[model samples]
Target: MQRAISIDQKKIDRYGKINGDNDIIHYDDAYAKERGFRGTLLHGPHMSGFAAEMGARKYGAEWLYRGRLHTKWVGPVCPGDVFDVRIDEDGVLTASVDEQVVLVGSATLR
Candidate 1:
């Protein structure tokens, strides 16, 4: 199954505040552009959380308590990007933006 997630500055700011991740790359467009990104980049963990949510939806409460998600951030995700989260029958999870694989991993529900 697949799900799409939208990332925006407001969501990024709120996640930053809750997680104490005040990195300029997550909110400072100028700073991020200076660092070679399109704009302020989405936090890796934030994307990972989205992947986890996909697992939860697929596996129900079992995933909530026993889900294991291992992910690698392969590309950058900017605000306003709508990315796809896909889970195959084998339980592999992948996230992509603009047809580029941004995050890849697997979700296991124990």
Candidate 2:
């Protein structure tokens, strides 16, 4: 299964506030851009939420109760970047931007 998703600065900022991560990489466009990112970056935890949610969708309560997830964000996700969260029959998940895989991992039910 696959779903298209888009994140904006407002969402990123909200997630940062919730997590108390005042990192400039997540809130300051100029600071992030100067550091070579396209813009403020999406939080790793926030991106991971998509993976978890996808797993729950596919596996229901078993995912919530017994699932373990392993993930890595290999590419930067900038505000306004459109991406996809996809899980295959094997339960391997990936988040991609512009066809480039940014996050790769798997969720296993214990």
Candidate 3:
């Protein structure tokens, strides 16, 4: 199955603070624009939620109760970017942005 997720600037700004991230790229539109993004990119944790939610849907909400979930950020998720979130049988989940791997990880939701 495929899941399409879109992240916005407000989400990015709030997530940066909530996740203890003070990176200018996450909260400064000028910085992001200078770096080529329209605005701030969402925090890794916020994007992780998309994958986690997908896992819960696939394996059942209780499945994550005792599992270890880990994700690595390989690419940035900018505002207005739409992407796919999918999982494999081995419980590995991936987030893709236009066919490029943005994040990869696995969960112990057994």
Best prediction by TM-score: 2
lDDT (0 to 1) per candidate:
0.89, 0.89, 0.78
Candidate 1 has its poorest 10 consecutive residues by lDDT at 49-58
True-vs-predicted CA distance for residue 31, candidate 2, Å? 0.7
Question: What does candidate 3's lDDT look like per residue over 13-108, in tens digits?
Answer: 777667788888887778888988767777878768887877777778676576667889888788778868888888888888887798898855
Ranking by lDDT: 2, 1, 3
Q: In candidate 2, what residue range of length 10 has the lowest lDDT sum? A: 76-85
Candidate 3 or 2, higher lDDT: 2
Q: Where does model 2 exceed 4 Å of error?
A: none
The estimated TM-scores of all candidates read: 0.94, 0.96, 0.81
Q: Where is the poorest 10-residue window by lDDT in model 3?
A: 59-68
Q: Runs in model 3 with CA error above 4 Å?
A: 36-39
Output the number of the lDDT-best candidate: 2
User: Candidate 2 local accuracy as lDDT?
Assistant: 0.89
- Candidate 2, residues 21-60, lDDT tens digits: the string is 9987898899999999899999998889889988898899
- In candidate 1, what are the lDDT values of residues 43-84, reduced to their tens digit? 899889988888888898898789889999999999889979
Clashing pairs in 2: none
Q: How far in Å is the alpha carbon of 36 misplaced in model 2?
A: 0.7
Candidate 1 residue-wise lDDT at 109: 76
